[model samples]
Target: MTTADSSVDKGSVSAVVGDKLSGRVALVTGGTRGIGAAICGSLAAQGAAIAAGFSGNVTKAEGFLADFQGRFGTAVTIHQGNVASADDCRRVVAEVIEQHGRLDILVNNAGITIDKTILKLTDDDWHKVLDVNLSGAFFLSQAALAHMVERGSGRIINVSSVIGEMGNIGQANYAASKSGLFGLTKTFAREAAFLLERAGKLSDDSVGITVNTVTPGYTATEMVAAVPEKVLDKITAQIPLRRLGRPEEIARIVHFLAADASSYITGQVWAVNGGMDM
Candidate 1:
């Protein structure tokens, strides 16, 4: 079956990069695979230390940790946490800071999808999706913000989806969860700005704190690969570019936002949707 895809491996470093993110530490949820893995590689290529978060895949996480460190030649480790739990969220942040000495960037990328029509969707379906996709990002961001606010600078980058804006069939819960990030990100950006300002820490030289979201349209990940060929054809046809997005495409934008130069940009959603939406 012909899938709208890219030739690059999600975790491979393909682009030319410099040490722009050097000395910074980034925590990426679900960073062991798919789009998340690509983001890790992108940041690592920019010289950022990585704390890759995975939920339950021990073997995969360990493999990713070893491989990522070898490939990037930077300090890299895997973190295990169920982001739906607030305590776990806090603990993960604390661990990252403790291990890395500080965390400069956070990518709330962990998410799950259980597809079922509304008539067949259970209470667990809706709640679990909301908890993992929406609440998880919130708790993680909240935990990270405490340290960021103390330091007067940090980056919170949320990975949302076009389905959130376009509302896919059998993805009502997923859509709501991803859409919720819009408000969460903007509010956090505002709060971070206000806090830094109140502390008299916002200055021309200050790196400052910022929060933003990246919403990707249909992307060529394992999840998308599982879709039937006909469905993929339909999806590609709707996309103006007629192709699924590459994970690296999404990762590049995230790296851009995580860099020091992006201090002035916040509370915005950067869409890499192949012109799926204007």
Candidate 2:
């Protein structure tokens, strides 16, 4: 079925077409594949200009950018950078603002995983996972917040994982990073709310911002493709839905939170895991 007809394709949060996000710009880290790419495509379809940030993988980034521009006729830009690096995060966001003039949405979706017992997991493994998964989000959000605060409006969506909420067998590093992300989300939400409240108290007419997180379950992404088929089947059997979720499903939620529909929601974690741990 076309995405238009599928239940998963709820499309944009905008009730009207063509101008739901008429003047908004969004940046998604690691937006070249899997859920990240899906969020970009979905947001573009909703009329938002999109900027995609990637650590490497120029080929995939270019291809997706072309596909998005061709399909939706929206301007889509791809940026190459190490999200774990504070400098790179600033560069990516600065370029986007230079091109589009403002930043409205930021999704911290780039992450990595190393599966091994703590006994075997090296310091390198632990640090790498935390660096990409947790630190990347912190740095990018910090940079983006500066712009959003200046504009007096924005949305930040951090992509966490169900594993972070309910610990997995051999994902100590991944779990810690994700759990930290939840904490980060809370702090961001509190800070944004406080800033907006203070602005309101001062009787300023300014657009406000919201921050939230989405934790996805086992999806058919490249990372999960690396798992053994038997392992995949075993994992699927544990989900209440008896299946894996599509990237688009998670993307829809991200888009909603990015849009005005979720203006009242923040500091929350939405789990798209098909009841995997429930």
Candidate 3:
């Protein structure tokens, strides 16, 4: 029997706590700060056993773990690895399963953007963005899907950016990677459909999985902190809301997609841009 059909019994304590998630285990990549940390806290609050990841920033990861446990009264382990490495991605999924015994969600939120104009952009700069933003998501999703497929239920949410869809100056590489994530999301949704068929289920019935993408606009994250206040002000002036988005706002949408509420939504990108592109 597949893992889903096997019905491995969980401890009563876990069952009680997991009721909100109800047999769910989630891995949130790049979950140490900003939107990632907010997503981790939001999900953990709803009773999902979280395996949060960080590519660098060991100090941030430790602090996040402490805060998460203190607030939730449950320990959330932090995994450190470069998501750009395929082997490291596999190890991430492996560790999550070894610790939690099942995988139900994967949030591909780890990304980096190197800003350089096309006229001055180096091949290294281009590949670096693609490696972290696109390739990292690709590898992690591939490895995580193995466990999700066996369980016959999963949710994969890829975090993208508005610049990816609307295009931004000095961020060609970053835009390209985020744009690529859309294609990957669509492809994975199809693959998940096939797996659902193997599990004798239809899209509207049974425990098949769904994959989607969430794109956030200029949020008050560290990445945007590098921009000068004048430039940030100019940028905010164009936003209909007259301000940057909050990490918690984006985290709310992610929390929804990770839950059963979004099972019917897949292969689509939802932007939390506060009318910047609308």
Candidate 4:
């Protein structure tokens, strides 16, 4: 196990409860900004070494990396690649393992959406969304599982959206991609369970690997910043909380599912939306 030697400075929050994830190595895709950035910060604060993956925006990524290092004194590596490509996914996972020596947490947080009403939606738009959001998660999980299985432990946290559960207008492609994650999570969990059982290690106390999905609802992030004020207002009004979710709030839930305490919570979709779709 990786040792926890970093100290939390005044700028950052304290470790979650018991520093439950201390010493683990985490790979967070799309981690340079917004929700992904928050997830990286939260995990690093809890003493996990972070490998942040970004497809572009080197300036933002550099800033995030510097801030993470300065605030938490955590080890962080920046990887540049498009998650939708299988070869890129494999390379990123390999690089993280090479740098950190092991992979314990894989947060498939990278995603994109191309919104258009079904009649107006082009085939390219549909394929692009599915490629990045659904296929990306699958490819990354496949790459990480090799190392995870070898160690007999790992956490795979896929970021889904509330649209997956409750459909949204102009988001058919996005909805489909996110909905696909639920099935993927359950399928991966069952496969891991079978492997553990075959090894005589399947038990409540020793579930080998945990795979879960975090679905955030109407979060305040760059992904949704382009929505017009009227549209944003409508979305907030529908939410019981009367406000959009902060990225950090979503990150907190992801952090929880990534910790040792969440060992029994595999194959579950933990929604962080504020009563948007209970």
Candidate 5:
């Protein structure tokens, strides 16, 4: 798709294009593929240097970087670490800062799910989901905030799900973890505001660091590709649009949040669910 129609631009860069994110740096977790990859591309197209974080799949990560470079004529650093691990989260943030000198945007897009009824869910299953989906975002945000607070500007975009707001069957752990992000978003926004105030930088006219969440409905990602055809059909039927969401569509919303234009938006949840949830 054309850049005007889609979040990503597939054509080669022919002329110098002035971008809103020029000279900025961004880090996107789980960015090797799917929705995360789209976010990386979108941000890069807008002239931000990108650091793509992935937990595993070295081959896929390399391919994504190569494709991104080809599309944008710029290389993206690949950071491989499990965001669920506090140490890894710290290391990831440090590496980004060391490489880019500063981080202007952070997208907490890494996540996983173990779909099972609570009755059938094992202890490992519950803990693993929460650790990755909920705790990971908290850990990474805390690590990134150290620099962001000092700079008095930053953007933190958390990727939540419609399931977080509207519950779904067989997703107790997943739902709870995503739901926790809403609280985290609000709390972080307040804390950032307080920090700005303490620094004597708070103003009624200007915005400090912004924190928000993006809830995506059923999207056509690799994870969802695993769903049985019959189950997928049922999911599509529930959507008023009668179709699944696209990763690029969600990425575009994230791009907007990461831009300077969205400075006035914070502690808000932007839903890109195609009318799946009001």
Candidate 6:
């Protein structure tokens, strides 16, 4: 049985929470603030160690570490790096493993948007969005997958957007990048299972790796806060819920997928949108 598949009895409750994610190491990019921050807190509450990734904001990074340690009282280590850089992605994974001993969950939550209409979008704008949003997820997943494959157990979760499904004005580049995640996630999901089977890791009672995506609607985050009030109101009116999502709402689903009981779930996209799909 894999680490996640191992059964825990009442006596082991102090060691690892039953049916919840515990004794796992998770690495989350863009994890210091916004939606990523909420994800970290959710996982930490379940007793997982966190390796929070961020760019180069020293002050914010320091505060993030302090706050999480105080709030959840869990083990957390912050890593600074550019997710767009493949070298940085590999290094961060290595560092996390070195610090935490092993990595069990990887959340590709870091993303950037360079919104502009197709006609107005420049090559740099398109590439930058793709590099950070799409390619960053790929590079980081690739590195994480290598370690996961060797160990024969892990979970990779990608964070996408509702805008990827319903395209918006002046966001052609952003939409394309987010949409690309769908294919990326599904392919990762299939390939992970195949590799595990090839390595002779699967059995009637044993489980292997899983990969999935979480598409969140416009949430009450700093990024969504930048939208003009009129524009935000129009967006809200389209939702069946008649309001934006909470970061914790999205975090809850992610926590589910990361837990031991979700072993059968893989290659799926969980959309936490209001009614945007309809």
Give the worst 10-residue stretch by lDDT in candidate 1.
1-10
Give candidate 6's whole-model lDDT. 0.86
**Residues 111-147 of candidate 5: C-alpha lDDT, one tens digit per residue:** 9999999799999999999999999999999998888
Question: Where in model 1 is the C-alpha error above 4 Å?
Answer: 1-16
What TM-score does each of the candidates earn?
A: 0.94, 0.91, 0.91, 0.93, 0.93, 0.92
Runs in model 2 lying further than 4 Å from the true structure = 1-18, 200-207
The segments of candidate 6 whose C-alpha lies over 4 angstroms from its true place after superposition are 1-19
- The digit string of per-residue lDDT tens for model 3 on 1-278 reads 00111122333223223345645777899888888888877776677777889977777777777666555533467888988898999888898888778888899999987888999999899998899899999999998877787777889999999998899899999999999999999999999888778766655665468899999999999888989999999999989999999998998888788888677788888999989987
Per-residue lDDT value at 128 in model 3: 88
The whole-model lDDT of each prediction reads: 0.90, 0.84, 0.82, 0.86, 0.87, 0.86
- Assess candidate 4 and give its TM-score to the true structure: 0.93
Clashing pairs in 3: none
What is the RMSD, in Å, between candidate 4 and the native fold over all Cα? 3.1
Q: Lowest lDDT 10-mer window, candidate 5?
A: 1-10
| RMSD to true structure for each model, in Å | 6.0, 5.6, 5.4, 3.1, 4.6, 5.1
Task: Write candidate 1's Cα lDDT for 103-155 as tens digits.
Answer: 99999999999998888999999999999999999999999998999998999
Off by over 4 Å in 4: 1-18, 200-207
Pairing residues by index, what is the TM-score of model 2? 0.91
Weakest lDDT window of 10 consecutive positions for candidate 6 = 1-10
Query: In candidate 2, what are the lDDT values of residues 1-278, reduced to their tens digit?
Result: 00111122325333224556766889999887999999987887777878888877777777776666556645678888987787887888888888778889999999999999889999999999999999989988998988887777899999999999999889999999998999999999999878767766312344478899999999999999999999999999999999989999999999889877677788999999999876
Please, what are the lDDT tens digits per residue for candidate 6 over residues 56-138? 78788888887665555457888999988999999999999987789999999999887778899999999999999999999
Question: Candidate 3's error at 115, in angstroms?
Answer: 0.6
